[model samples]
Structure formats: C-alpha cells, structure tokens
Target: MKTYETLVAEALTVVPEILPWDLQSRLEQAPAPLLLDVREPEEYAAMHIPGSLHAPRGILEAAAQWGFEETLPELVRARDSEVVVICRSGRRSALAGRTLVEMGFKQVQSLKMGVRGWNDDGGALEDADGNEVDPELADEYFRARVRPEQMGP
Candidate 1:
C-alpha cells in the first residue's frame, strides 16, 4: 500500500496549489485554473463553481480511456489538460486529483472546501459548460437538490 502523500505524488508531475479564495483570484487574474467538479450530475446541476467542468468522480475512475476514447472526446481532452477539482467538500477531489495525475495529467489540485466553500466566499455559479446560469433560479435549483437531509450523515 502507498502512503497518502505517495499516492498523491504518484500521478502529479507538477501538483496544483490554490485554496478556494486563491483559486477565485486566479480565475479573476491573469491565468485561470481549469476547475474540475467531480460531483454527481444532480449535484452539479443544482450548483457548481463558475467556469468548472463536470467530469463526475465515476468518470474520473476511468481516467485512462475517459479522454482517449473518441466516444468521450471532450472528457478525454480534459484529462490530458491541467485541472483543479472541487466537490461538496475537498476529500473526493484530492483523491480524484491524484488519480488524474496518475493518468498522466501533469497538474491537478483539489480546491479547499469545494463548491460550498466557493459559495461561502462569494464565488459565482455556472453551468457545466461554463456558462452563466440564471441567478433568480439558481437558489431554487440548489434548494430543491441539496437539502440538509439529502446530505449524508
């Protein structure tokens, strides 16, 4: 078995490093991180980090063929690129980031605190393809999907 750091180091050639606020700043400033959201489809639909790409955790599990296969060209292309992942919290992205690194992606990082953290810090929301969503409907969409009881205990 590999140590946690060892596992993390395995795939990452040049690991990405940016907390939620820093990431938000990166998005606003010069170069932006390719924000990857690894949540479920429903979760992503309800809310997600602005400019984030959705490549759910299950898909990420098959990192090798996810991008290379013509059937999933967009996802595959993303796999080959640098990305920073976000989930509800940060654990899943950390694991996924390591997996992405292992799959030969040069850079991957987990956003600290995920989408929840981003929203807390006043980051904007966007659709899966990185387009702005209707602000009026955004809260309704989120409330319908991500209720307190819906979250796991």
Candidate 2:
C-alpha cells in the first residue's frame, strides 16, 4: 500500500510551495495571500498564523464553495486570489493545495515546512488569546511524541 509520504510526494509534484521567510515577505505586499490552516479545531485553537482561516482538511471542499454550511465566503471569493495552505507539517498542505487547484482555485501554494518550520525560522504565531507564542514554547508544542502504538506496520 502507498504510504502518507507517497501521497504527499505526488501532491507536491503539482502544488507550488513557499518557505516561511518568503511567506513573511509576501504577507507585506499588497493583496496578501489568503492563508488557510487546515488542521483540526483544537490544533488551530492552540496556535496558528495570524489572520489564517481555519478550515480543517476534512471540510476543505465544502468550505471552498458557496451554499454549504461550511462555506467560507472569503474562500469562495478568493478563487482568483493567491492562497497559501498551511498545516502542522507541510504534508497536509501539499495535498490541500492540490485539491484547491483541482477545484479551480488560481495561485494556490503550500507552506513548505509548515507552522513548525515557521516557528523554527522566527516567524510569529499567535495563540487563541492573540498573544504571540514564545519560540521556545512553540518548539515544545511541535515536538513529535508519537507513542509506540501509533506506529504503523
């Protein structure tokens, strides 16, 4: 069976990517890219890129269009705008970006290395409280703590 890495790799072939520093610069320009954080609610509530719209990976398709309960007006309107998809790691965003492309979104890209790399590269992150997360604290949060049982065969 194909692994998660295999899927992400396939998506990466089609999804454009931007590094954290480049993203920071792009954010300063006119018509800043629409940032989409596709992690679960709890993960997003913990911390995310400021002004990012949270549409979990599970509901992305719905959120991208109009008339659905999950529809995000901004996303629907941004079909022609630059959009950046982000996740804890870069993997999910790659797949999500590909989905956006398939759905006819123009100028879609993934945040390479994701929020973890952003924090590592001194990019700012705000908690649910809107307080900037300390780099050290973000580091703690990003540590991979997979239990033995979570490993696949």
Per-candidate RMSD vs. true structure?
Answer: 5.7, 1.0
**Quick one: best TM-score, which candidate?**
2
How high a TM-score does candidate 2 get? Answer: 0.96
- Give the per-residue lDDT of model 1 (tens digit) for 34-85: 7778899988977787666677888775543643332344445665565788
Each model's lDDT: 0.68, 0.94
Q: What are the runs in model 1 whose C-alpha is more than 4 Å off?
A: 1-17, 63-75, 78-81, 127-153
**Cα lDDT tens digits for candidate 2, 1-153:** 999999999999989899999999999999899999999998898999999999999999999999999999999999999999999989999999999999999899999999999999899999888989889999999999999889977
| Candidate 2 clash pair list | none
